[model samples]
Target: MKDFSTEITYKTSRSSGAGGQNVNKVETAVTAIWNVMESAMFTFDEKLRISEKLKNRINSEGLLQMTSSESRTQLANKKIVTEKMLELVEQALFIPKKRFKTKPSRGQVQKRLDNKKKLSDKKENRKFKF
Candidate 1:
């Protein structure tokens, strides 16, 4: 993959939570935006995978936007958003290993049947006889 950071764009606004006067005065919150479809880092298939995995995060215009306001400084929030976006893209590209189904052993299956039978007999014994 090429430099994903190169294609990223950022927007800033006043953060809502905490930071007291800093929050109200400065635009500390950072919003990272990247065009997933237009990104040259990944192929079409990989872009498709990313879009599918991050459907909720991607806007109608096809821009993947993420916001971070954890820190009081704009730089910290910007760094956080970049890292967050990279991590998400990395996760989306990963392909999980296929699981092979296994059947229960014969002994285990027989034991299960025996346990059922024992329970049935115990229940049968609880009934009053004529």
Candidate 2:
């Protein structure tokens, strides 16, 4: 995961869900915003890749915004925001190692040839004389 020691800025807003009267009273939900261009944690190349991969999550100003209201506490929501940010960074940084092309081994080639010869012999024996 990318080492992001930067503190993400968040604004609290009430969520519209089945939370009863307490939902309307308390603004425990957290909405965090991190501008990809302004982030000091990621390099230019890393930011570009992350922005492209997470384009759907970013807003018009190229800010990666996320909201978490799963819990009733602001601290819990803040933790969720951090988790989400780390998750996105980890996903964007993942690069599959390239595989080297390889030919069939001699044992495998011989096995295939033997199977073909066995099938040919079996077919030859199945023929009926006039």
Candidate 3:
């Protein structure tokens, strides 16, 4: 896992979940923010790639927002938020290997041509040639 301690920032918000009275009272939920544009963890190229790939998840200001309300306890929620932040950063940092172009095998190409010919023959047989 990548280290995102310096990259990400966190904020607490009131949780709306199965915490009963605690949910309404304490701000236990965590909202993790890691702005790709402002992050030192990723390079410019990586940031651009992340911004493109995770456009939906990013806010208008280019900050990636992740919220955690799975746990009632603040510490647990904080941990979850931290882990998720790391995962998000790692995803952004990843460089996917380029795909190599290749042609279909000779046998597969022949099979496809044969299938096309069979289909054409069947269609032609359906028509009563005048």
Model 2 alpha-carbon miss at residue 39, Å? 1.4
- What CA RMSD would you report for each candidate? 1.9, 2.6, 3.5
By TM-score, how accurate is candidate 2? Answer: 0.78
Q: Give the TM-score of candidate 1.
A: 0.87
Model 3's alpha-carbon lDDT is: 0.84
Query: What residue pairs are clashing in model 2?
Result: none
Off by over 4 Å in 2: 5-7, 116-130
Models sorted by lDDT, best on top: 1, 2, 3
Q: What is the TM-score of each candidate against the true structure?
A: 0.87, 0.78, 0.70
lDDT of model 3 at position 73: 80
Clashing pairs in 3: none
User: Residue-wise lDDT of candidate 2 within 1-130, one digit each (tens)?
Assistant: 6657374778899876757898889898998888887888878998888888899998899888888998878889888988988887789779889999999999999999999999999999999968
- Residues 1-130 of candidate 1 have per-residue lDDT tens digits of 3459989999999999989877779999999999999988898999999999999999999999999999989999999999988998999889999999999999999999999999999999999999
TM-score computed on alpha carbons, candidate 3: 0.70
Highest lDDT model number: 1
